[model samples]
Target: MSYLLRCITCGEEYEPTETRYTCDKCGDLYGTLEVIYDYENIKIEKEFEPKGSIFQFKDLIPATSHTPIDQSIGGTPLYKFKGLLGFDELMIKFDGISFSSSYKDRASIIAVNKAIECGADTIYCASTGNAASSLALTAAGTALRTVIFVPSTIPKGKLTQLLVAGAEVIPINSTYDEVFSLSLRVGRKKGWYCRNSAINPYLLEGKKTGAYEILIQNDYKVPDYCFVGVGDGTVISGICKGFKEFYDLGLVDSVPIVIGVQSEKAATIKHVFDKGKPYTPIIEPANSVADSISVGNPRDVIKACKYVESTGGHFISVRDDEIIDSIKEMSRSTGIFSEPAGAAPYAGVKKMIRSGELKRTDSVCIVVTGNGLKDTDAVRSGVEVKTYDIDEAEALFL
Candidate 1:
């Protein structure tokens, strides 16, 4: 089976060897390329029990390399999260276990693998934190060099991971959007491979593997709804794409409604969704404790909005305080430590409950996207520190 790169807008097909991210005619950055698979030739005996890792579904993936830098990219556990806000059937897709402790590893692994296959030596991307760390780590495992451009205010925990991975980290005194734009320019100028989400269509192919894993792990049980915290809208888009592919392939009965959760400060996609039709993103200063999802201008807005609306889903935003509260509450209740963005879906769920949007009987799955330790500052701020002396051990115990 083989795959080709096709422009989602102009519908122009290109050989897999073509190295552009968008349609050559349209040149609309948001109108990015897509991975088109030749499904008829590929036959899957059983998607449930993959022979290896995500590569078991290699027929669907668009990469030429069967060998991955890390084989443990997929197969994350989907645990039953019982009795959350009186919902009987609630599950959490814990993707924090990805090699780099973030869901972005799904994309990084594929992007880096494709770069190596294409004979590129250096891979570049711009991220708030998780994407850069994942890309850096994956690139380090291979002979590829990694250059990450990040905002100066990136979390300390993620910054440490980038340095430890030996990637050339450039901290720019600017916002995420600025850093991302600069990365594109520099990558093009230096003839380096760009691993940025929404820019590289193969990244979505990798991320969509998580959705394939989720559906397979559930025994092909399609949930009524799927919730994800949206930053650049890549994750939700990938999940939507995966579900659609499975549904089309007759692997699943139906596709779940994908709900995109975003922070109030970073509600660019949400605002566009609410307006309907003329989907133009409005940029603003995105200030949120969930740094990972704090993007003023989502790169994959067009596809993300289309998928959510087509599936009868919604786009909702919660305040920074709400995100922090959800992080604390979810960590205590489920014993799953999640970063603010990872737990933002729960905040959206809370809003749904209050507004009567989500019912008590709806079977839903919330994607826990990243490890809480990635943003220790957010965790520390949520927890209260009490000073106790060894002499007053009784008080401490009490």
Candidate 2:
């Protein structure tokens, strides 16, 4: 790995051998370590092959070893919206096609590999659903063990996937933030490698591969705007980091305006951005249909806020009904079934257009982060079902 872990707060740099996830001097509860690449001396091939999804761009990632998995983690399709929802210059990155049916698969791939590289026997993390399922499946594929703590209120479908993947699932009767705090302490005490979002800098490296894939897939053209659903905000931060790297390497001339989507029920980070206030944890009862992107206190809010502001992006919050409607609209228009959180980006697009934040001529990309199958309850709520006999069905069709 041609990278070093740098503290985002203190600017202290450490060798890749250091396993610590936080700055020694920074007292913030959500400190993030960033990966600084040796871009000048790094090697890039004239013709790159994406044989192992993100690993195909192995030289860009921070892992020292390359272990291929059975399932691919990146290279999801970039499809045009085809004038869907009255937007012409819009595209969607279907990250839901991942093995775990979520964008977290990309990060899990790198986190599991980093675990194996560091010789860690067990890894632990706090997730609501997608992240846990992704980590569990990736660990299982790589012959690694994982302990995942999630809120008991997580969707039944995602919970089942975690258990079936053979992860030590501990569902706490509390909010995601509570589970996250407890998991961090327990992971440190048990000597298990913590793969928590924001804290694990390598995970960001993994998520950033999607940005690389988007640029490459679009023939190296940067979109005018990119919308992503934010929970703990690590995914968007990683994407911004990826685009920044490409810009520094002179691959792309400019970074896109990376907008963040949040459910109004749990839009703490969005509120902060909207008001232009100092960082403060907003703890409340967050009950949103888009459960995947519902977090009261995002762990990587600092990086997320900084990225969006610096890149000319804005944070938008949508109502639960808007999210549900977006799910059906996107599925109907694009034939891609997306979970509430995945559909959140579409809702953001609609809001941007209505509020004049996004223009009709501006190119856009909505990062559909997960599949609708992960949250069938939300999908079912938006769909209608009926059964009829053959004769009745034929008569209705006729």
Candidate 3:
């Protein structure tokens, strides 16, 4: 590994010997720990072909020379969005259909690699939905002991995914915050490796693979803009970090204008962006169909604001009805089924077009984050699923 784990605050890079979970000096203020890479040795060529998954660009990542786990991750599709926007260059990078059906799988694979390298057999984590499925499915590669704690109100489909992955699923009737706090305490006492992004510094590195894959597929050219939905802001930050690496390596000319999408109901960042003030410590959370972006208190909101502001990116918020409609629109137009959170980019793109926020020539990419299967509650009502005998199944359609 040629990278140093750096604190977002002090700008001091730590050596491998000094690698700890968080920054030693400015742990509280930094808010996020960033992995700084040695970009000088990197040579970005237009001819390079990425591996079938994220590993295809291993040379561009901060992975151990001998990756401990060789599981399939990354390499999701980037499809063009049609009809709504007049822009010819807008595309939605599909991340929902990851190995276990969420962008979290990218992080899960790498997190598990680190855990396996450290020789941890048992793993535990707290997630509202997507991360739980990712962790369990990735951990199933080795079939090592894994446990997932999620909110009791999680979609039945997501819960079923965890069970099928051979993970011990525990539902806490409390909110995600309560479940997260309890899991941390229990995890420390039980010696289980914590897989939550709140505690893991390398988790960002894993999630950054989405950016890497897109760049690789596009011949290493960074898009003019990248859009993502924000939960705790880890995924958005991850994408930014990936582009930063390419820039530092001289692989790309400039970083993309990072666009953050949040549910209008939980539009805290939008409030900060619109009011032209520093973040307010307290904000109210409202209910929305995009439950994935429902976190009122984002752990990395400070970093998110800093990244967007420094890179000249903007935060966009969309209403719940718009999100639901975007999900259907994207599926119908692109044939890429996505959940509400996954369709968030579509809503943002539409808003941009109507407001004349984006130019016609700009090359843009939207980060669709979760599978449509995760929350069938929204789509199940409108779409019909038919069951028939084998003999009549094909004949009826004909």
Give the poorly placed runs of model 2, Cα more than 4 Å off: 28-30, 43-46, 49-52, 277-281
Best by TM-score: 1
- Cα lDDT tens digits, model 3, 1-398, are 47777766567777643125566676533545777666677676655445466666676555542333444577778776543367776777887767778999877877777677677778888888899988888888674689888989888888888999899999999777667778877877887777877467678888887877778777776788888998777888888877777677777788889999999888776666666646433455645678777776566666667677766898999888898888888787778889888888789888887898888888889899898989989776776778999879878888
After superposing candidate 3 on the true structure, give the runs of residues whose Cα lies further than 4 Å from its correct spot. Answer: 16-19, 25-30, 64-71, 81-84, 272-283, 382-398
Q: Where is model 1 poorest over a 10-residue stretch in terms of lDDT?
A: 44-53
How are the candidates ranked when ordered by lDDT, highest leading? Answer: 1, 2, 3
Displacement of residue 223 (Cα, Å) in model 3 is: 2.8
Write out the backbone clash pairs for model 2. none
Per-residue lDDT tens digits of candidate 2, residues 1-398? 56787776668887766367877786444467788888998756425443347777767887644456624678788898656767675789988888889999888888887788788889889999999999898888666778999999999989988999999999999989889999988988888887899878788888888888778888789998889998888899888888887787888899999999999998888877776746555565677888888888788887788777878887888998999999888888889999999999999999988888766778899899999988989868556789999999999979
lDDT of 3 at 358: 84
Deviation of model 3 at 45, angstroms: 3.2
Q: State which candidate, 1 or 3, has the greater TM-score.
A: 1
Residue 57 in model 1: lDDT: 77
RMSD of 2: 1.9
